[model samples]
Target: MSLITCSKGHQNPEGSRFCTLCGEPLPEHNAFAGGINTGLVEGTRLRDRYMIKYQLGQGGFGRTYLAEDTGRFNELIVLKELMPTGQGTYALQKAEELFQREAAILHKLRHPQIPKFWELFRDRKGLFLVQDYIEGKTYQDLLNNRLDNGQSFSEVEIIELLQQLLPVLSYLHKQGVIHRDISPDNVIRKEQDGLPILIDFGGVKQTAIDVATQLAAEKYGGSGTRLGKSGYAPDEQLRLGSVAPHSDLYALGVTAIVLMTGKPPQELFDAHTMSWVWNRQLNLSSDFNKILQRMLAQRPSERFQSAEEILQQLPAVSTVPETRVQPHLTQRQITSSNNNFIPPSPAPINTSGQGHLLDNSVEVPDEIVGWNWGAFLLPGFWCLTNRVWIGLLSWLDLSVVTLGIPTITISILLGLKGNEWAWKSRKWKSVKAFKRHQRFWAIAAFILWALFLIIIIGVILFAIAIAGFGM
Candidate 1:
């Protein structure tokens, strides 16, 4: 049988519509007959260089195609077209503008985890953007495959994934860009290095919003447009049309939770209480849980202020030395002496009981049950030490909103209650050590308070001297 090579390098029989191995479509034999005059088809070459292999995917705004750059040793690339479906002249114009914007944005971005822009041009077929093709499956596909095998991502794997991906998010944020859509479907794990590459920029959504607003003003004399995936996007991005770096963090948190439990955000979130219920189903370390809670906070202000902050909170997983252990002693018992040690292999989860999935043999500390005086005294320090990033952000937000007037009171309250939250969320060597740490922070808080008072008195006396001179 005659053979054909799919864009993904899968070989299939000639006349086959799809590759048997990867399920990618094969280019039609006569696709290039009409050339640019008949739209993008198999074998059709653009700019006398890129050869269209087959269509990859399509949406309302445009279509993505798998193509080969013939001028560059037939290197695989993705070709994006700005062909708005069923839209009038105005909508088409807006799409073209956004397409240019996406190209510009991609051109300026220089991250290993982001696709590199190759070229942007218009031909008889219409506008097209060429970018490096990522050879990998989307996170959604990975999640689905794992679910099909009755396996879900472990806490450690999720943490590692976050560590690998957050830097990319930080890079984007530093460049003054907000990836408004950060769902599992938009992240691809590269086959070469298993590194997650973020795809699908939603800045075009801004153009869509403009088009919708214009249409609304022409019809009902109003303005508004809805953008973002449900459950993944925060309230501000969905309702108020406001997006920030934290908005992407919220979606990232949702993605992590979904990977952990293999459940959709809609199913995990409880609308009645406005909280996520997935915690009840999964056995996660307190610190990890706290980080996720902050990431998925209802208010953007309560979420991690930046990706770097979340990275600070993530527990470092050390590589355990490979050593044969006596059958009598379990891995937990062997590592009991080392407080920072994490077992190379995680114990299987026991779903038969109400307790955590953690092994019973392991003596993990329980979360604190009551108020934390140290937190009330030094909220910022306590949060920094305990890795409760949301608490720290909350303190900062309160200070800013209150114009620093309520700072002392807020600090006092945080000191009173911070230890409880911190202890519950953090892992320490022992209760005694945790208490000692809190006490140290409390002393620091006292010094901070003293400095604050000194500053206030200095300002007051200076003002008094100025008034006396005026008299």
Candidate 2:
């Protein structure tokens, strides 16, 4: 068989059953008629180093093969075979060049949560990417297993998973790398040495490249829209082409929904109504539900600003120990790290119903909700003292000063209170309780503001009535 090359540079047997380089089976060839004709033989040596062992798995982009590393004294390894394609061979070559560029970025990341790449090799056949072989069950596999059992994980369990996964994202974001494709299929959880290790770093994106430039080109080609699983992708990543750290968080949120519900995200979504079904079906904890909603927000801006932001914002698992929690989770830590732009700390966890462990007495007041007598008093004194110096109030000035001044005062007071209680105080026994306290004050402030608006409207209506009656 003369080494007949396809347009993609894949060599095959003279009358082969498939494009041996890629497992593109020869047209009309039976699936069982295979006997490693042209590809690397089971015992064959590559570059007089790594030895091919057996085939593992094959996909559109590449094929994974189990092999032996001779340089490492025949250490077991996995080879990812990158195939050549015809439709965009020139484009694919360019893509591979781009892929290698990104691969260099990933090679520098050293985290136990990330998969390790061994080496990249090329020969007369094609390009091959060799990485460490991690044996474990993928999140997808876990979902399938639970589905088979007609059961799903509890909300607490799902949040615990998120706690572990979010940290991996935080580390990546800190390094300026984004895992654009964060579907369950891509996240593998292996129990190695009694610890769960995250595997697969194939879809990482670097901050160096112009995301818009590449994104615009691949919007219709599954490079953007189809990069994730259908239901689990964020609305922005799926529809608006916004890819950021939040995009990963959105996928994780979707995965959490699936994990808790034991169904794929599409099943939980009502296309006609354009709403999720989990809320209707499950009686979920308000705290966990809120976190999920934030993660799945349709707008990127409305979502967490960064992976660290998401980590900081995620309410700690009610049942998990604080030490297992990430440091970025408390609002104070996030604000402190941000220099002067500090957000108030989260409220204490309410251990009511399932929150029995939470203690409200020790919880911090929401800095945004607590009373700031100083702000109100100072502003009132300034206005009263200066009234004689200023002229009579115009209609516009009255409206502005009447409504705007109070609104501004309330906002400042709440901000100050939130800052004091949530961030500054470590008096609370549990950070979870502090988180709950913050939520309570936030809701209370909102209700109070709404009532103030109602009262103002009532007074305006009364004034109009008096004027009309007099006239």
Candidate 3:
């Protein structure tokens, strides 16, 4: 005998509160009460606008519908109706409160990545939240096609995808909004622009103390409770109680891992042990692997503190150092001013849109680009230094010079290349004349080499003097 039945009078889960025909919300009774068909009735409009069109989707606690706004003007929005999860009447009250909280949270957030909130309405049907209707397919759709086609994305492609989301997360975290649910299902990749849009605010938690106070929040989505998807939730998120930004980072790490390996992280990584799958074909670089490992750390504190900090380490998507601007002075100021600044009124500097000033006359420094010169040469600086030191300390000076000189030169070039990153990061604060002073360092290096040779010769002469007595 069928005990549990849906609104269409069809057997369903015990105490189901949804329709079997359309999956619409049924009357509230109890947690395990049978669903009831209230018969179709036009819901009462709230604030004299937002006419309910039809049901779009329904969950255990709420029903979403496509609605038209008539109060201010005719605007299209998806209205989520907060309905009771079970047949219990108390469930209706609790669901209404949750829906209101969701509305308040949504209204506070405004980001390019998140959907825009339209309005919140409550009337005969129940509490409803209207939000932007993003026209696009979810990330799940892309992942599905990727699996079907046996598709693989390059590191650069993955970076481009994350470049959009990381900044979004940074903004959200700064605003104290923790997006507890971040998975392919919630991410919408637009066909027109090919950018991922984060949706589904029902699971979003506002950490802002002031705004959070307005809406009485019950138990938060914490770790150990397994609020989010199994593989994606961080150690902290599964516990339950308090949620943090790193919880989202854990999900992001899982998302990237899945995208790269073409398998859910659960299949590859054991959250309990934090171990990768048995010898999966690894095509990614060691650096990327290290990044994922850090983000998916068992401890929240061990993960990258913030999205901004994580972006700093990623070479592919990091922001280049802004170019420094040279201040443009009037002819009068340049010609006059005692050849230097003499005026009490200083000339204004404009750096609105400019790159770093460069000395066109001199060649670009090697430090800006990491170009290893010694890779082509055998027996590098260390080899050269050993030969010189061993020869001078002993008696084989000629043999040492022959082995060491070329290696030393190659090592110098490599050192310059290695130092380029540091040099480029530094803003050239010096004027043109100061820029020319860099040549002095080159001259100094040669002078130091000459000095080393002189010492070696002096040492040889002293040894010869001692040998003369034996002769």
- Output the number of the lDDT-best candidate: 1
Model 2 lDDT per residue over 245-353, tens place:
8887887777777666666677778889777766664666666667777877766777776666666666645433322111122344345645554333323333222
lDDT of each: 0.69, 0.55, 0.54
Note each model's CA RMSD in angstroms. Answer: 17.7, 22.3, 24.1
TM-score, every prediction: 0.59, 0.54, 0.54
Give one digit per residue, the lDDT tens place, for model 3 in 1-471: 334433224455555544343232333332323354232235645557777676655443345667677764767677765544333444445555665676676688888778898766656545566787777877766766554443443454465567679999998899787787677767888654556898765252221111222222333432222245556666556555357888888788777766655565656775466665512544555566577778877777788889987787774422222211222344566677576944232221211112222322223443334433222122233223222121122223237657756445545544444223223323232233223333443455566667998999999999999999889
Off by over 4 Å in 2: 1-41, 87-92, 193-196, 202-226, 239-241, 318-471
In model 1, the Cα lDDT at residue 388 comes to 60
TM-score of candidate 1 to 2 decimals: 0.59
Worst 10 residues of 2 by lDDT: 386-395
